[model samples]
Target chain A: MSTGGGEAEFEAALREAFERRGREAPAAAGLLEAVLARRRRQTRHRVAGAAVATALVAAGTLLGAQLLRGGEPAGPAAGVPAPGIFAAEEIELCLLPGGGDPAEVLLSAEVGGEEVQTAISEPAGDAFRLHVERAPGYTVRLDVLRGSVAGEPLDGARDVRAGDRPGRIGDAPGGGRVLLLETGTEGVLLRLTAEGTGPGDAELLAWAAKITVSTGRDACES
Target chain B: MEFDDYVLTRGDALLRFAHVLCNDAQRAEDLVQEALVRCHRRWRRIEHGGLDAYVRKAILRQYLSWRRRRSAEEGPAGDLPCAGGAPDQGIEAIGERDAMWRLLAGLPRRQRAVLVLRYYEDLPDAEIAGLLNCSAATVRVHAARGLARLRRHPELTGRAEVVEDA
Candidate 1:
């Protein structure tokens, strides 16, 4: 996995994957246009204090510079929205391994944002997110349970000042960095910034603290 | 790099990238059309900077930055086109390719883009850094992690990327 000197085999394999995907997936002029339209309208986060790419990225899905105050995500909140309501037809969710079972889960939501999208995936999946981004910039991601500071359950979840002060969240008691982040649909954001850490390290810690996961329910669709 | 020329020349590449990111045809078109309009809006600034490169950077970044809409986001009645078997399955192995995309859809954003630029777009680390606004090392990290995961994929078993030991 070393991104070192000329590795044709590795590079070729990468190309092959995309080529294979392109051929398998239907290709049309309009599909490209949809991506264009979406990308054009998406917003960018203004990054401060170098060391990372501070782009807000895609609508309400903005990346923040906050460090995980420290801890893991709280246990699933009860009386939460059904996983089905979260599922969308056209949208697919790629669940990467952050020390969890089903190593990787690739799921598609049903589109309406009312139903939850669900699907199982093989373990040993890698890191990368390839899918359409259509969520608005101002969404209040209401997860019944856990969402680490690293995770973006609530769209953008930043920009607007938090009406309620930031507090602690995590299920496993006694000092984990998990907290149930809550914000209105107006782009209230939460970010975990691991001070004096690299992006990868920070991301790992963040995932540990905040990864929206479903341990009990296998699959659901509304 | 004028807006007019970009639409004419690099539009195809943009469309192609959009298609890959989205895995759907019609949606890809709408994405590009919107990207084109935005590019045209900033045509003057882009021409001075580097039209194709700017548009490309913007497009890729935009793709990453936009709010992710799930299939559910499409109206209750309207669904994002579902993936179906291609008619030309005989000509091309559709399932295999779909498997690859399915695999890709599982990854996080930065890793996906890094892989796209390094392998698909064939841009070096420095250029990728320029595009992603990160250090060269970060780009290398992303490329490495992304490739490692790709190699682990079974379909990619004989694709010539995985080392025997790897």
Candidate 2:
């Protein structure tokens, strides 16, 4: 037989087979309900995922705004402690123990072009730290007295050369160390106290020595 | 028209069409159900167009792609039971129809789909190509190859080539 006849005859047979099937069709039954339920489930998942993502993004934005608004810097700079820890809490005079005589403020330091009153006070160690709050870092306590005090030798004091001046490094009553420097007529004591880490003794001593002291009258005296 | 009304009316015909595409009654039900579910999900967008044609295309796609699923890789030739509710046609006619079904099932699924679309559905070559997502030439080739294979079935064609009536 020719290809054309084969095509027509096979086609006829296929049609007959389908006609046999056309007699019985399955019921629609619950097909629509099943499909609609599937659609609803997909919609719920999509909406829930979108909602969670949106909530996360909004929370992140709010947290970022709050951090920016707070005076503390976002993160610590390289090799530096976090700024919030080191920032000064209060800037006031470091008064003496009796309050009758202030530690002779050799020269007041200028913070923002205004001379900030500087006095030396020996409070109970904890109060000393709380009252003498500077920026958020270790407080660099510098005391330059008019003359050396005749007191018992400080405990745990070790001899060290701070620049040309021979000084003794001793642990303070609180959690930091102090450097005692006697330069003939005037004596300087440097101490640093903070909640966390502080600068090395050599660094603090150097910082204490470099206090740009002016031989002017004390601001508290005026 | 509402989706419920449309399905209620046209669902039976679509099921029959799916049965012709895939001989298994259960598979046909699944195919039609999946297609209608997809249509319902996108009803707002597809409601403006002819929903019947859209659903027919979806059913054709589902049938075509069904073979790829490992679960759907069933041997169509093995399960050749006669469908329920046969017409008053004699047993000889039923045997001939079953013979035709086995012959048709032995062919490649794409070629069988081409035959079903062309002969059973009375679709033109171009229309079948659109439903199959192929070129008209490809449809014709599949049809020719499928018919050639069907003629080779010894029991159905009596070991003789089928001849077209002039």
Candidate 3:
């Protein structure tokens, strides 16, 4: 069947088809409840998984230390390191805010030491994912979000400074290090994650220091 | 606006939009639900404005990146029954619409997305490009190719011409 009218007629038919199909959609009853329930379940699973992983890491560390010390019994606090000097694993970072519109990068930073490509994945959202060639397969993600840093993993984080901004340094899950810093803007927090087996904490901190978080109109100005 | 309140008010519309995007009711609901969950998480930041657009973008992203769904090689499925149409519509028109639907389902995901956004959503090429993360030229290319393929389909070629003549 040839529509002598051509493209315009075909488009009209297509639009009508879409409208008809759209109207047949089922009612979205209980969708909000389902979403909330799924979110809660996911949170529970993450928390439980983190707890198990942390326990195993702590126990393994204690056992290894004991074995190294000629089978001497390790004390309760033996495996736990000071806040500033955490094992390169066992820290869990909080999830960044979702649904942020991708914004243009108003500021940029240089990553010293490693041959890394720094990109602002969502500059408006203040999130950056740095692909460090030195680490081969690992990615370093830095997310800046509004509000002070408050979460489960911050319990043992030690205070540090990135540039002039105050921040905290701690171990991150999967053999990585996390640096949480306060940006120049009051109430905005920045999180830098050097994935496991990637750059050392010192290098990560150095890279963090190079970042300049500006208080532009957007949440992630820099 | 509160997250729950927003969902209550606009959930059906979002679901409908998702349905048009993916051409599957169940998958559409899943997309909307996932987008809403993300929206709920960041409602505090997005609630100030453009909340609907953000959620719609989230849904579109999820639909585009959902690689685990049906393979691209799969054949286009038959269209679901249209709920309502013109009172005087005839069988030929219905057949034409069904053919169009099947042909649409056969197009590449991005092309289908471009067509839907252009015709159904009535969005500009630039806006569709933004949602799809491509240039406006690419959007037009997709739309052109998709429409070309649909018009060329053996099923719609004759029926579409007849409809146009009518």
Question: Which lDDT values do the candidates have, in the order given?
Answer: 0.44, 0.55, 0.61
Tell me which residue pairs clash in candidate 3. Answer: A1-B157, A1-B158, A1-B159, A2-B157, A2-B158, A2-B161, A3-B161, A175-A196
Q: If both were scored by DockQ, which would come out higher, candidate 2 or candidate 3? A: 3
**Tens digit of lDDT per residue, candidate 2, span A50-90?**
56544543443343334322434333311332122122211
lDDT, residue B162, model 2 = 29
lDDT for residue A159 in candidate 1, whole number 0-100: 23
Model 2 chain A is weakest, by summed lDDT over 10 consecutive residues, at: A82-91
Candidate 2 residue-wise lDDT, B134-155, digit = tens? 9999999999998878766676
TM-score, prediction 1: 0.45
Q: Which candidate wins on lDDT?
A: 3
TM-score values for chain B across all models: 0.75, 0.81, 0.82
By descending DockQ, how would the candidates be arranged? 3, 2, 1
Q: Give residue A24's error in model 3 in angstroms.
A: 0.4
Top of the candidates by DockQ: 3
> Looking at model 3 chain B, which ten-residue stretch has the lowest summed lDDT?
B71-80
